[model samples]
Target: MEALTLYQLNRRIAELVTNSSTQNVWVTAELSDVAVRGGHCYMELLQKDPDTGATVAKARAAIWANVFSRLRSDFYIATGQDFATGLKVMVRASVSMHPVYGMSLVINAVNPEYTMGDLLRRRKEMLARLKAEGILDMNRSLCWNEPPLRIAIVSAEGAAGYGDFMNQLNGNQLGLRFTTRLFPAIMQGERTAQSV
Candidate 1:
């Protein structure tokens, strides 16, 4: 028997993956924690069963730094909400596998509007369900003043929402002096939960 050369092994792997399957899919999922590491941003995209409130499926995805930076800015400008935790997103991605990382999705682009719409729909559904269960008004029955003075905010370091939140909190109009402590989190994918 003859041993395969490194180049031959790599070529075979590439061919196998490329020809195994090809699909252009639109997936709607909740964006949890997002983290950028080593020039790559990793995140988890998940969806839950509407009636049961149980997760249906989840996947690991990544955006290379170049793509992430542009997409991040575009998403924020298009939608008031930052592309961070608690945001819903619709992604056009390719299914890929890494030699070491196993299965992953390489996100090509995003539809912020679609994501926002999905989020709103999900929120409405959740609210309706809670209302029917007699728990929707539980928190609304209580009221409290906004915090004064120091604010400890936890968010991604350069996330657009974080910046906006800080700006509003420190703007001169408020005339309220305060210090901000930002505890950065992974913000998007599977690591997001772990960081929190």
Candidate 2:
């Protein structure tokens, strides 16, 4: 048997990676983590098993500063939303391997409308499922009563929305009174869905 050092193995892998795939291959996955450092955008992409809710695969991906800037703007223009965590995006990327970074995808393009369509389909499916289960009309199903004066707030404490809401409610000129308490939570990015 022959032995190879880490550098030798990585070099071989990098070579294999370079020759194995073509540029501009479209891939779809959920963004697990996203960060920007020194103008470069880096992210972790994850694919999950829908039925079992388990992660199927994960990959490191990057968008160069220049490419990220244009893609982010274009995505926002198409979707009216930020390109942040928890989005399932379709990206055109070149598969690459490095001696230090292992395998990664170099992203060059994004299809924001793909995710928008996916989200819309999921929402419609959820609504249909809820309706078929006789639970879709939750507000109408519940017994009627006047809305409660007391409210429990759940949001990140420093969020502008929270500040504005508190100010509007507390400083109402009509002098409407209510009891309110805020439960602070991470309001954005990957943690927000779990926070809520």
Show where candidate 1 strays beyond 4 Å. Answer: 1-17, 20-24, 122-162, 174-196
What TM-score should be assigned to candidate 2?
0.70
Q: What is the C-alpha RMSD of each candidate to the true structure, in Å?
A: 5.1, 4.5
* Candidate 1: 10-residue stretch with minimal lDDT: 17-26
Quantify all predictions' global Cα lDDT against the true fold: 0.75, 0.83
lDDT per residue, candidate 2, 17-80, as tens digits? Answer: 7763556798999887787888888999889888996889999999999898898888877876
- Show model 2 residue runs off by greater than 4 Å: 20-22, 125-193
TM-score of each: 0.62, 0.70
- 19, model 1: CA deviation in Å? 3.8
lDDT of 1: 0.75
What lDDT tens digits, residue by residue, belong to model 1 across residues 1-196?
Answer: 9999766676666567654353446667876556688877788877877699577888888888989888878887777655675567888887775555666678878998896786678779988999999998997787759745777887778877788798887786958888878888866544667886
